[model samples]
Target: MSAPEGPTFRELAVQALSSVQHGYDLLAPKFDHTGYRTPASVLDSVTGALRGLGPFGSGLDVCCGTGAGMGVLRQVCRERITGVDFSAGMLAEGRARTPVAPDAPRTDWVRADVRALPFGPVFDLAVSFGAFGHFLPRELPGLFAQVHSVLRPGGTFAFPIGAPARPGSRHYWELLAFDTAMRVRNALWRPRFVMYYRTFRLAEVREELLRAGFEVELRALEELGRRADGSPRCRLVVATRPV
Candidate 1:
């Protein structure tokens, strides 16, 4: 499913007017059809990169909207895989679509905020995709700490970060305009829906990961190709909890 089958403009407008949680709830059923779901190519690229880094035992996907990251976990993890999200509607969609078969490793769905992950040092690997923009930069220290707390010693936390949109490019201006509108809407609105395209800079994220006690390394996801200057289009950040 793609844009042609996705929500209408009016439907999207109603969703944008709603609170974040409620908005996703309204969007969940049609999410797979929307452009918002991370592309399978990106997921495949990350999974390929993580394969060399793991034979991870148990995996967790934080903010696992509709379980897009679950297939990645299924490929790498040996024992169990879980996806956690605050949106019950998203979780329900994920559950309905989860491709578990007889003898497959257990897949669990938990509804919880990623800022306050609900587990101990049990998972051997954790991942998140396309969700960080929802978090304020100030929330990252605590958020990274929470992810750190949930990983077993030496466990990996990985996610993909794309290069910032080029200045003066159509993409850049589009994001700037969208963010401007969102800021104005939030200022005038009741329930603030936090989503920003330009907030999660790689440098700041790396610093916060270090502060959270992660040993961070970044590897290019070459499958996504490189930019004009030869920089990777996307880099996968692999942060490991200390042994």
Candidate 2:
């Protein structure tokens, strides 16, 4: 995919050296310009898939950086939409850009950690996009449980999951090098920035959702096309908080 408009090299370097919260805050003004934002194609595919399941009441966008998922919720949820993340600057940028139509659900931007979301069983749907790499695998159970706790029984938490990069592929090596660099940087730095492309294993994530009391399902996103092996390039993982 093409890269989004983003920050400069020196700016990125400064952000990378800072703490995660501060780093994102520094990048927030130009975040949408960055490739870190979720792609419109993925968002559209999810919006299409969720349309069949919907006419939902309220929705939450977990770890919403710049409100792409919030826009998705606006299309489907009838009552309210909330975007939660710990980064104050990201929330500010999201609020500035993600305006609701007069006919759309009312929107709220919350600054809170996704691991400890501050909501009860009030939402009929929750979604996140392109935010999983920021979370370590070990924290997923608690994280999924937090999402589960905020959803009404039978509510769904959905996100796009791409096929793992094949070993020795260009993408695979790029991710490997990036993760290695991140590990080294974190080891030598204070207040680690936790992001690893390889850590969000689908099987492990499905198991964690199950342990969090979610019945999981995966639906191919046909719009994104297929891999060389004919498997879907990306699948939307829908985990329901069972009633």
Candidate 3:
């Protein structure tokens, strides 16, 4: 979960004791050292898929943590790119790390909560990476509605979703244990940290997206490879607002 430069156990423990926003603020400096940052391989795969779908005008990265998904937006979007998040520390780190050339597409960082995004139906494309677990199941309707509200007609909101771990598998047990631990911790602690591993299922997500006025489509991320049953290990969910 971490490299040599990542946070120590003590540091992580302290962060875990804080609210989700404050915890991320505490972790912002060393966030990239940990496994929480989305991998470049996943970003590249999404970029390739989106390149075919795009030449998009302006793009937004929803819940952009330290601007990893901004790389994907840069590759595919044409005019301007914006990243919005609730954490000031994370946004500051992103501004410091994300480079800009004189001729590069315009870049902007806005600090706002994703549940109530502050934007018009302006973006042609929007992408999020590995940040959905923070929201509970009941929040899906409002969350999807917020995303849908920010996309122009014919715009897309895209993200990757991994296949569930097979029952009885080691990975399955690991996730189950992690989620149970989180549940217990939230129950016992104040200022609950809302990160769980098992809540976002594809079928339920599709229903919510449709309810939010998106026409949903699922495409296999073939670059991520297939599982034992020949299903894709990861799939890209492309939800488009109607024109």
Candidate 4:
């Protein structure tokens, strides 16, 4: 069957007003149809960069959403792969789409918040995509610590970070407008939908990772190319727990 169509503006409005889990549950079926799912190119670039670092025994996709990141983990991890998210609706949709294959890494789905992951140091790698914007800046340290705690010694927690939106671009204004609307929404609403496009700065993220005891390194996904100032257009942050 063909994938479902994307959500309309009213549908998106309803989603924005609901709590995050409920919003995602309502959005799950049409998520991939929207441009919101991690782009395939980003996924491939991340996979390519992580190839030599793994043969990873087990992997986790934190806030796994509809399981796009799990496909990347399935390629690299040898033993097990799991996707965890707080929304049952999203997990159900993911389970339906995910194919099971012989010799495929074992796959499991758990419904849990990333801030309070319920696992030991069992995974050799963990990843998240596009979900960081949901987390407030204050929550990042705890979130990073949770991911770090679930990873074995020397295990890597990796994710892609794009260069900040250029100040004069349409993309910049779009993000600025989105953030302003979110601020206004939060001020007027009881349960704020906590999505912001601008809060997850690379420098702030790097500092939080360090404070959470991760040793972080960044490698440009050069296939994505560089910006006008010679800075990379995109980079993958590989944060490792000490062995």
Best by the TM-score measure: 3
**TM-score of structure candidate 1:** 0.98
Any residue pairs clashing in model 2, and if so which? 5-33
**What digit string (tens of lDDT, one per residue) describes model 2 on residues 53-142?**
998999999989889899899999999999998999999999999764788788999999888888889999999998899888888999
> Residue-wise lDDT of candidate 3 within 92-163, one digit each (tens)?
999998786876689999999999898999999999998999999999999999999999999999999999
In candidate 1, what are the lDDT values of residues 53-171, reduced to their tens digit?
A: 88899999999999999989999998999999999999999999998588667999999998888798999999999999899899999999999999999999999999999999999
Arrange candidates by lDDT, highest first: which order?
Answer: 3, 1, 4, 2
Question: Candidate 4's residue-wise lDDT over 100-129, tens digit each?
Answer: 799899999999988999999999999999
RMSD of each: 1.1, 1.4, 0.7, 2.0
Displacement of the residue 73 alpha carbon in candidate 2, Å: 0.6
User: Candidate 2 — which residues are off by over 4 angstroms?
Assistant: 1-5
lDDT scores of the candidates, listed in order = 0.94, 0.91, 0.95, 0.93
lDDT of 2 at 41: 95
Regions of candidate 1 where Cα sits further than 4 Å from its true position: none
Per-candidate TM equals 0.98, 0.97, 0.99, 0.97
